[model samples]
Target: MVDSIIPKPKRVDGQITGLAGELFVAAELLKRGIQTSITFGNAKAIDLLAYNPDTGRSFTVQVKAIRKKNVFPIAHNKINRAHTYVFVVLNKPGEAVQYFIVPGTTLEEDPDRFTHWFTDPKFPGFNWRVLQDLGHEDAWHVFSEQA
Candidate 1:
């Protein structure tokens, strides 16, 4: 067995995969006539920022991507009301990616009970289950909602 402290190659792929997802999100939003741009190098929690020039609807978008077509984990600290999340699944190479757009508040809310999980730091393994359960699959209206 070889001993080396260098991180595995998969780690680098993950970073590129993440950036690919962010680009895909930006492209989709732009295609839909939403003014969108990626935050260079993701210096902030937001990966993309979008605005509907006509209505001035805007969102601070955080994108999460996974190589497999499954829900991805989001760091608990990154959830916020002024934010929207774009979940992406990188399909086969050169194939179109899949996306699920959801609002941050929905991440925290239990619509039936009026409770939330996003603001709770106690939760370490919080996935996008709540947002998924809300049927945000490709739901783009969350952006226009701010208008």
Candidate 2:
């Protein structure tokens, strides 16, 4: 038996990428027994709001979803220590998803390293580089505070 390519994408075009990333993260939070609410639309910078009912701990999540494999740039106009960044990388066709939860302070401390402008085969724009070496990968404990 052979495995099939990644599940067919529900929608075509790049318009849905942002929403797809947001929903994907939101779903993961929910699966972890955390309550999540999406704040769609350009009205707010926060994409998802997560909360832990038991600890009364809530978090403002800014999700950055990258469909292609490049250094994705995250806007750093407003950096809030209380906020968390959920970097969702939708690996190429049929691959698993990658999540990097980073605290706002991580970026605020050194804005230049994370945020920058560059051109790739895909497009030319600014994005915050989410490198795994930072040790922030899958840092969900920012909300749970568990070891």
Candidate 3:
């Protein structure tokens, strides 16, 4: 029923999906009056940079996105403690996008505690569930606090 409620895209493009997620997060941050910019590149670690002029504060964000509700695969070595993470679910056309805002320190502190690592020798990355169980959906206040 949940799957049915959220439609799936007919085709998936990794590049487009990733860019869309970054844009969506940027838009949300802008809506909250936070100045945001997307750092575009294949090798870039930080996707979005947000600043709050009122507080004179700024922070980096790394975005991970999927077309539907599923585990986000990430390399354990890539987690940066100074960056905040935003896991995005870009469901389908007409469906609302879901965002899970989490601090990178939460993952870097103890990755195994929050992610499921693949046992395969070739593909040794971990899958993160995006703190859904912890109720981090739409946690836009994270930026406010950081500010």
**What lDDT does each candidate get?**
0.71, 0.73, 0.80
- The residue-by-residue lDDT of candidate 3 on 1-147, one tens digit each, is 666787666787899999999999999999999999999888886899999876778989999898887767666677788998898889988999989888878777776666456323455444435376776788888888833
**Pick by TM-score: 1 or 3, better one:** 3
TM-score of each: 0.73, 0.73, 0.81
Off by over 4 Å in 3: 1-11, 118-130
For candidate 3, report its TM-score: 0.81
Q: Give residue 16's error in model 2 in angstroms.
A: 1.0
**Predicted structure with the largest TM-score when compared to the true one:** 3
Question: Distance (Å) between predicted and true CA of 15, model 2?
Answer: 3.6
Model 2 regions more than 4 Å off: 1-14, 112-130
Candidate 2 to truth, TM: 0.73
TM-score of 1: 0.73
Q: Between prediction 1 and prediction 2, which has the larger lDDT?
A: 2
Task: For model 1, state the Cα shift of residue 132 in Å.
Answer: 5.1
Which residue pairs in model 1 clash with each other?
108-116
Best-to-worst order by lDDT is: 3, 2, 1
Tell me the lDDT of candidate 2: 0.73
